[model samples]
Target chain A: MYRLKATFIKEFKLLSVDKTGITILFIMPVFLVFIMTLIQQQAYKSMSQSGVPVLLVNRDRDSLGTAVERGFSNFPVAQLTVDHGERYPNEDAIRKEITNGKYTVALYIPANATKILEQNVEEIMGRMFNKGQIANNTKVDIGIIIDPTANKPMVIAITSRLKQYLADVKTGVLFNIMGSKIAGMMHAEIKGGMPQEDIFSYKENYAFRDNRSSYQPDAVQHNIPAWAIFSIFFIVLPLGGGIINERSEGLFIRMRTLPGSYLSLLSGKLLAYFFIALIQFLLVILLGVYVLPLVGLPVLHIGSNIVPLVLLTVVLALAAVGYGLFIGTLFDTPQQSAVFGGISVLIMSALGGIWVPMNIMPEVMQKISSCSPLNWALRGYYELFIKGGGWPAIQTEVIKLSVFFIVCLAISYRIFQHKTNTN
Target chain B: MEGKACIKVRELSKQYKGSSYLAVNKLSFEIYEGEIFGLLGPNGAGKSTFLSMLSGLIKPTSGEAEIFDHKLTTDTELLKRIIGVVPQDIALYPTLSGRDNLLFIGRMYGLSEKELKDTVDKYLNRFGFEKNGSNAVKTYSGGMKRRINLIGGMLHNPKILLLDEPTVGMDVQARTSTMEFLNEVNEQTKMTIIYTSHDMEQANTFCDRVGIIDRGQILKLGTPDGLPASEGCKDLETLFLKLTGRKIRD
Candidate 1:
């Protein structure tokens, strides 16, 4: 225990005195989080106030196609612009416009859309009139052409609104036909052909509600945890470089002559780095929750389940420290460790959805993200913030992170032991 | 001051796993308590390798060594408590103050907080760096770093001190002070000092007994005064050149 304490104190003191290291580990993370949140907040505010640009290509000059275009125009958040096939000439030209980034999303109403709708409506009316049912065989496909590089949330919002509009139109038409048929039957049953006061009444109702308390999808909630985890893992570069420096300077060889095992030495260093990770995590959280809010950014929400948060932080720190130790032990020089550690963190962060949300990524990329420890940590944070999940909700992530920590630490210990013994 | 052997080597050998040549091969020797023993050799003469084996930094391939009746291979923990090793390089943390570095190393040796503070202060004063000890080691001169490195090893007050080229790359004044301080410590504390060096002149004047080594084997071992007479040379350097051949080792 004393040896571990000594090692920890030594490492902590050394790191604390390194101005560049401290800046990279702590200041840089907070700064990045602040910058990202500010930028995203501005972007979201602009999107809400100015609305997203959507191009409507109504090739079919029929009632159904006009209804679809009218639905898009009615949406308050969509800045609808209509291209009546005269400006773009054809479907290929419209697709090229979207691909060229002139518009974020373009909706193409196919030529037979009205014909299909009319057939379906006639079939429903025919069934109500005691006639044989008509088989509506025409397939109407509404082609939603979207720019692949557009902001994901904006594209999804536009697409979903368009789908909702189509569903509403179809349902309203069916309800009108059914209501007319029922009214006619009621009038026949009534003695005076249905009094004016007894006329049928129709209403449409829809609502959306969230049960989770204090739930707001803001940039702070996402960027805070994301950049924090990214920075925590980035400690690998400095920690590994420190170890390599010590080894090259012969301090490690001198340490072997001390009355302690290699495990004790490694434990001490790990303990110090773990605490550093914890401090960094807390500082970033505080910055997001308090500091950013003072500058008009949205406040970050922390869940009530503090235990899960602490556990996840510890496990993640262990994994990071273990990775650093492994790199330090495996590499012979500080330069090698720095290069490999830096590049590895960047790649892992990219794959882990730190730079982009996993849900927005392609299916294959999302699956690949699950293999990154950063992904596991981000998922845990998302559960706490977005899903309002408690301890039980993050058990899977916690277990996976713990397993990663153990595996990395074990491998690091073995390599360090081998290196120390051989030297 | 003759006494029971403080360190005993029994056919100790080390051949790196892939290397064809043995770094230290079938070497055997003993240094009595309170003796200043110098292991003299050229670069790559296995001087550092031999010192490393004694300090328990590396395992011997064929044989073993014992310090104060404790076998180095099996009783490393016990041996560590009694041996202070000063490596050939400046191993102290460059970012830390000299005092802090010493205190840290002292704690690793299990010194209490109070004892560590006092020991660090004492060493700083002894080395005449009390005023500048608080400065980071990176800011110190080469000689100052060497001094702090030596002080770090002996802070625990171990019975055996193993130094590998402790005074390398020092100016004449720095070398003289370091040698004098080492000699004074040996005489006052009756500490067994075993050092390896390439400077034959310092070895001749400072060590009570010297062993001349070459290619992993000790060519001659005796009192510095006696070895030259036996080799029919004017001095220890002449004797070394005569025995090891005048070829420069890379």
Candidate 2:
């Protein structure tokens, strides 16, 4: 055990001294977080500012109507004017202006609009009386046309609301003038009851604003944490290879001759790798919380959600280290371990939902992914971020990860035992 | 073999599981205390396999080796402490400085920090590695690296040191310097040194006694001077060539 401890310390020093190892451990992940934060910030800004650009043309000579149209102003829907002289512009000219993209909407109200309103009111009142409903409500239609260039959803929402408002106004006018009194007289004469009050309330709700033009898009919940977990996973490759390297180099023999056991040596290596992994996790989480929000990206709830994510992730990391050790013992060369080891980790990580979310995957794929420990890890993070979860929600994932650690460690020990007997 | 010595082997043999032949067939040898011994043979003479058995690196198909009055097959941990084997390969980490490698080796031997530091510096300076000790082993020449490999084994100053082809690929200056340094340490410490080499001349010059092993058997064993005198041959090399007939290569 003492000899093994010495081997562990030695191996750690070797890893620290290697320039490539140090960079992989400390520099790469930090740099990646920085770049990701910058991109996310820009995306959020653009999303917030994204708006449709529209133009308006009014050929109507009515001054009151023109003033009503002028009252509505927004950046997405801009009103551009085309003047007509006393003779008035031809309909063909108006169409030509609209077709050339000078205006998004065109309006024209005829000069005899007062006469039309009088005739339509009388005609509509006679039809309402025939149907046994109240009558003589004013009806008006200022001719309006929409450009094809306008967004379909925006046009639909606007047109539908306008029609509904017009219908409501007609009803309101009738009730204010005569319909309410008529109903009251009937109620006094027979039923001895009044009409019930109808409460009407309307408000608009937006989940996320269209602020894209001003800031970058926020990183969706899974991307950063999943990427962070995978970065921790990659640590296993180098650390496992370090053990194989020492064994092949006769360092173990030197160690055995010393005063320690194999267990102590392996523990020391696990300690070093675990701490390095912890540092990596902190750097990524800290950057996600502090640095990501600077350029318009909202920070993830790290203070509240990071603890369970880290606890489970650390357990997974330890399992991965053991898996690496298993491969190291099985393979003769570091290169062999690296190639097979990397591919296996990737496959398991993919199955575990590190590369992709397991929820959207096919049933069979989900089942297969569930077999991987990473699947539970990502799901735990997803719960924290998406499901508003706390410790209780992630307990299952932690337990699953713990099981994986135990199983992989047992297998690793078995392989080590077998190899030690022969080599 | 007749006496129960510090180390003993009887009808010891090993056949690599997948191979068609035996590496060491019914091999046998013995060594006593307070002696500098050499396992001398040409390439492929099973010198390595022989030493490997004593070090307990691999299990014999049907044989046994004991070290320091303990059976190697049973008391592995105790055997490990009693023997230190410097492999034929350069096993030190290339990325680590010489001192760090020594400290690491010292730790494996269960030495404390101060003790390790003292032992590391003592060996580093003794081996003339003062200026280059701080540099990574990768930057050092072949000889310097080999010396470090040798030092790593002896950091705990084990009672026994086994070196396999220690000077196989070094230049003249490095070869002489390393051998002389080892000789001085061996003489002063009175530690048993079991070294294997193809250089009959160096072995003849340095070893207290030598064994000419061929086909996993000790063909001859005597002091460097006595072997030739008994055989009535010219020198150690001539006797070696005569004992093991020359072929182009094995």
Candidate 3:
């Protein structure tokens, strides 16, 4: 028992100074969860989820700005709040409204934006007609400030709509320039600026394919648990490397000579790394519950039946640690452990529907996904999180993860015995 | 060399899996208490294998070895408590300071905190590591790392020390200092040591008895000077060359 404590202390000391390992364990999961949730929120947007509240801060009171105003007024996907800078004085008020979920996006058109766009467009027309016009360089940067918590599809929809309006106006001006030029060459008198034609605007039509009303695209519900599981499994990297180092550096030989069971020495590392894995899960879950709501996303709804959730996380972490130890003991070098362990984890993550939810996958692929431990883990969390389940619903996954943990440790110990502990 | 037998071996043979020859052939020897014994050999002469069996790191295939009548096969727990192993490799953790490494190894052998700290400090001072003891072993030079590795085995001060080329990579000054420190420990504590080395010059003055080994068997067993005198060679090096032949092992 004392020996085990000593080993644990030694491992903890080694880990404390390992800056790279600590960053990989903690920061990587947070980044993954945050980025994946923000980006994939668009996948949840449907026709029923349209008409997002939008604020237009138009300081450019010219032709281009009026075009933007007309575009937003007719925008099919937005509830346009056209303002004359009275209700909201500056960008900060718009940002406050966005954080409070009143508006999903704010369009800021800077002063003189119209003049720059018109000049650049005229230069483009001059270049097209081969008129020896003096070169002019000007740029128009229309700012789009989005709610950080807004889903990706919403931002893409708004930005692309604004871009189409600008392109249409540019084309209209180019055609008017061409008409005036042709009239001048033929020496014909033009009436009312080449008689501008009314161009019909085209709009995008979304096709609604499925009526799966049961599934809601909740960013916090999906990403927090998915990425948490992934980050937990990533514990394999450092743990496997630790095993290889012990074997190759003769630490195992010296350890075998010590008056203690191999399990005790093994426990020291598992306990330390297991703490890291648990902290990772907790951090991610906290971010989901608190941080998600501030950005106008749904807060993660982990029900009051907290025991099952904690139970599943512990078992998942155990499976990850066991897997790490098995990879370390089976391989001879850090390179072998890293390459094989890393590739296997990523493959498991893909098959487990970590990249895409298993429900949308082909039935055949979904069946194969059941073979991945990550899939089992993810399914367990989804049961408690999405289906409002408790111990009875998640028990099977718990048992499966427990079995995986046991088998890995057993095989690792057997390998260790065969390779080094001949006595 | 006159003392009670601390370790006894009889027909100890170890034929590794898928190998044509025994790594440590059927042989018999006794390592007495309070003496330094050297198993001098070339690269593959099974000196390491022999020390491994004595330390209970590996099992003998067809024979028995005992420490004071405690059998290696049936009594490993007791044997592990009685022996210290210094492997050819630097077995200490690289990221840990030398003092921490010693304290951790000492704890593994069931030593108390006070004993561990005091013994670690004494050995660190003795081995010329008074200043570098608090630094990580990774930052140390090769000779310095080897010193820490050697100290790791002796932290608990076991009854027998099994050293496998403990001074292989040390410089002249480091090697001499290490040998002198080890000799001082042996004189003051009466700890029996089984040291293995390929260099005859190293084991000549250090070991009280030298056993020239080749092909997993000991060819000559006597005092270093007596064995060379019997072979009519100038030293253990020439005598080993004459017995094992002039061919290089590796």
Question: Using DockQ as the measure, which candidate wins?
Answer: 1
From the highest DockQ down, the ranking of the candidates is 1, 2, 3
TM-score, chain A only, candidate 1, equals 0.74
For every model in order, the fraction of real contacts preserved is 0.86, 0.58, 0.72
lDDT of 3 by residue, A1-423 (tens): 788788878887887777887788888888888878877665454422567788988888876778888988888777788775777767888778888989898887777776777678778777777866648786787768898877677678888999887776666666566667778889876666423455678865432123223444466787788888988898999999997888777787788788876668878889888887899999999888898778777888776669999999999999999999999989999999999999999999999989878987899999999999999999998887776778988999999999999999899889987876443
- Evaluated at residue A403, the lDDT of candidate 2 is 80
Model 3 residue pairs with clashes:
A42-A153
Count backbone clashes in candidate 2: 33
Could you tell me which 10 consecutive residues in candidate 2 chain A have the lowest summed lDDT?
A: A208-217
lDDT of 3 at A106: 89
> How close to the true structure is residue A147 of candidate 1, measured as C-alpha lDDT?
83
Query: TM-score of each candidate?
Result: 0.84, 0.75, 0.75
- Where does model 2 sit among the CAPRI classes? acceptable
Residue ranges of candidate 1 with Cα displaced over 4 Å: A54-74, A80-149, A152-214, A360-365, A421-423
Model 3 alpha-carbon drift over 4 Å, by segment:
A41-217, A290-298, A417-423
Model 2 regions lying over 4 Å from their true place: A1-5, A51-223, A247-264, A293-296, A304-310, A343-369, A384-388, A417-423, B1-5
Clashes per candidate (backbone, < 3 Å): 0, 33, 1
Q: Measured against the native two-chain assembly using Cα atoms, what DockQ does each of the candidate structures obtain, in the order listed?
A: 0.72, 0.46, 0.40
Q: What's the lDDT for residue B149 in model 1?
A: 93
Candidate 2 lands at a TM-score of 0.75
Cα lDDT of model 2 by residue, A248-305, tens digit: 8766665444444676667777767777777887888777778766755677664355
How far out, in Å, is residue A143 in model 2? 21
Candidate 1 structure quality by residue, lDDT tens digits, A1-423: 889989999988898799998998889988888888888888888887777778898877786678778877877667788977778767788888887878878888877677777668768687768777667646678888888888777888888887876776676566666666677888743233222252568864322122564355778888888889999998898889987887777787777788987667878988898899999899999998889989988888887778888988888888888888888888998889999999998888989999987888899998999999998999888888766787777889899888988888788778876765553
What ordering of candidates by lDDT runs from best to worst? 1, 3, 2
